[model samples]
Target: MIEEIRIDNLGVITRAHVELGPGLTVLTGETGAGKTMVLTALSLLLGGKADPATVRRGAASAAVEGRVLLPGDAPAVARAAEAGAELDDDGSLLLVRTVGAGSDGVAGRSRAYVGGRSVPQAVLADLAEALVTVHGQADQARLRSPAHQREALDAFVGEAHRDTLARYRAAWAERARVVEELDDLVARTQERAREAELLRLGLAEVERVDPQPGEDVALAEEADRLSHAEDLRAAASGAHEALAGEADASGDALAATEVVDRAKRLLEQAGGHDQALAALATRVAEAGYLLADVAAELSSYMEDLQADPLRLEAVQQRRAALAQLTRSYGSDVAQVLAWAEDAGRRLLDLDGGDQRLDDLRARVHELDEAVAALAADLTQGRTEAASRLAAAVSAELSGLAMAGAELQVTVEPAEPGPYGADRVEMLLVPHAGAPARPLGKGASGGELSRVMLAIEVTLATAPDSGAARPGTFVFDEVDAGVGGRAAIEVGRRLADVARSAQVLVVTHLAQVAAFADRHLVVTKSTADGVDVVTESDVRLVTDEARVRELARMLSGQDDSEAARTHAAELLELSTVGR
Candidate 1:
């Protein structure tokens, strides 16, 4: 519930502080005394659009602030906490809206704050759900929208209907997923076939060549040795001749082994005469043995070296085959083998495309049937609920000073959407002979206000209202076209609603003001040598002062004995059971 609201520099209201409490609170004033401006301030606090024209003339800006108290576990409380808003010391949330006066004739920008923390206007709008329900001239346009009408009907239809809506939404979402996958498979059929064919050709070529991981490197080594075979043989044979004289060489090349043998024989002969000579003789013998072993290895190497043209040609051919594979697929045989492994896997998936497509198509068909069934059920439920809602709202209109007014809620077939396959429209029939017309058409503005009020009251008091009732309700000119007994009944209904929630009304009827638990009167003056509407112009009237105000409202003459007498009697009737 709203604890208080302050409006500054908005319309003719320079500054005004309105303290609200539970039960019926009424504000009565002369025309253009800033009564609607107070409601406008409430709208701003609820995240309504900010028009620069609403700002007071010559004022730099306009502001509206509200203090709302909510339960600790309320949804708005949690939302405000998420936005980093802090509760006040007394546990009330502060909401603020500021509209900057635009420069150079441009419209001003608006900013919203919750619990002293800045937030998007959307957050303020969300918070409004738990705070209050407001009805004004603006809502006449709202009643014309089909979407809004559907929402109002749905709210009255209760929780089971909402659960049905949830199920329909889920079914629709599933169908969309299936359709998307099915479309992808159908659209890419030719593309998948082409990809699989290319992969098959590449894999076939790779299998035929059968290259090993390091075959290219090993083959290159063999090719180099084969090309230089003659040079290698010559070098080995020369080393053999130096180590041990070549058996077939005609030149006089003394063998290294023979020279070593001669040195060992001479050392051994002198070894008995000198111990040092014996050690030298042993080393010379070991050197001759080592030289003989090296000569044998050199001989074996020369004999084994060979240059065969056929083997060399075979190696060159194998290398060329491996090179072809590497050119198209990789830098080498190892990389080529890796490419083949990936292509083989990808080819398997593409080969199964037809089977996957069959499965996806079957799934899509199943979901399409399911979604259509759910949409039908939703339409049927809405049709039944529509009838009940129409009767209820029509009954409410009868008591709102429109004896024969009837509200008709219609649900008709529409193209299936995320919501459902039904279009909801609320129509009004003003009198017995009148034809039913859409809510926004063929009705006076005052009648429209009453019609909406009836719908709202019905929804709020309905056993299955879909959600909790808001803690506060604001009505602007709900009694605009009502008077006498009808005005009294309007006040009584408002008072009844206020029994469970806070009710604030802006009205000019004396009977309505008489029912208020608290009364405020907005007045304008040309004091200070200028016409101004300010906080001082707003005064809470009580006791004899309230009687005087009511009298003024009754006959435009507060001092008249008859007017005061009637005003006192009205107040008495309203307070009788208190």
Candidate 2:
């Protein structure tokens, strides 16, 4: 429930602080004294659109703030916490919205804060959805819409219908997803086939070449060795001749091994003369053995080295084949292998398109049946609830001075939709033998107001409906075309609704204002010869002050004795059972 609203620089209300509590509260004023501005401020607090033109003259910006008391575990509380808003120790939330003009003077924007934390305007809207519900002339105009009519009927049905509707919506969503997937698969049938064919061709080429992971690098090394075979052989042969001796000639030049052997023999003969010469002899013998081993390996290499043109050509051809695969698929043989692995998986998916389509089609058929069953349940619940609602509303209209009026709730068949398979509408028969007609076309403004009031009162009094209703209800000019007994009934029914929750009404009729537990008056203060800077003030009135306000509303003259007497009588009647 909204505890209070503080408005500044909004419309004709320069600065006003209004305290709200339980029971019916009414705001009354002269034609231009700005009673509607209070509702505008409340709307702003509830995330309504902000208009710069509504700002007070010369003020930089307009702002509306509200303090709402909520249950600690309420959905709004959880949502506010998700937005990083702090809650008061008393479980109260503070909401504020400020509207300011842009630098260009033509564009404007709004800022919202919840519990002192800055948040998006949409957050405020979401919180408002769970806080207050406002009814005004504009809302009555929305009664013409079929969507709104259906919503009203569903709300009247309570939680059972709501649960069924939820199930239907879930089923509808699943069906839509399945249909979308099936349509996409059918549309891309040719494309998938073409992709599969291309993958097949590429895989065949890769298999034909049969390239190994490191074949390219190993083959390149072998080709280079064959190209330089003769040079390598000549170098090895010369090194062998120098280390050992030429195989066919006498030792014209001493080889390295012969020199080392002679040195070892001299060192061995002088070993008895000095220990240093013995060590030198050991080194010379080791050098002679190393030289002989190297020469033998060189000779073997020279014998093995050979150049073959046919083998070199085969290596080149294999390299060219591998290069072709690399150019088509990747930068190298390894990358080409990776591409083949991934393409194989993709090919499998493309080839299984028909089986997937069949599965999706079967799933869609299943969801269709589920949605249809849930929608039927919803329609049946609504039909039963509609009968009780129509009867209750009809009884209320009769008491509101519309004699012998009949209200009918018609649930007609409609194409399956997200909501249900029914179109709910409200019809009214103004007199006993008359045929029922649609509400917008069949009822006067006064009748429509009373009808809405009857519905609200019935819903509020319903034992099972209280948990689903908003905490506060605002009715603006609901008594517009009503007067006398009918106006008194409107006030009485509004008070009845207030018995369970908070209700605020803006009215001009004394009959309606008299039933309020609290009365507030909006009076204009003007300067001489100028309405440009006029200010409107709102203040709570009681006792004699309340009497005078009602008198003025009744006769446009607070000083008239007759109007004052009638206002007093009306007040006395309003308080009979309070």
Query: How many residue pairs clash in all the candidates, one count each?
Result: 0, 0
Predicted structure 2, TM vs. truth:
0.88
Roughly what TM-score does model 1 have, to 2 decimal places? 0.73
- lDDT string for model 2 (1-578, tens) is 88888888777777888888889999888887777788888888887888888887667888889999998778999999999999899999999999885456575678999999999888888888887778887777777667887887888888877887888998998899899999999999999999999999999999999889998889989889888988888888878878887433664546777777888899999997999999999989999899989989998888788888899999999989999999999988999999999999999999999999999999998998899899889889889888888998899899888889989999999999889899999999988999899987878888888888888787778776522777889999988789999998888888888898899999999999999988988876664533321223678899999999999989999999999999999999888835
Candidate 1, 10-91: lDDT as tens digits: 9888889988888899999888888988988998998888888888878889999999988887888998998889998877
Worst 10 residues of 2 by lDDT: 527-536
lDDT of 1 at 148: 83
Scored against the true structure, residue 436 in model 2 reaches a CA lDDT of 92
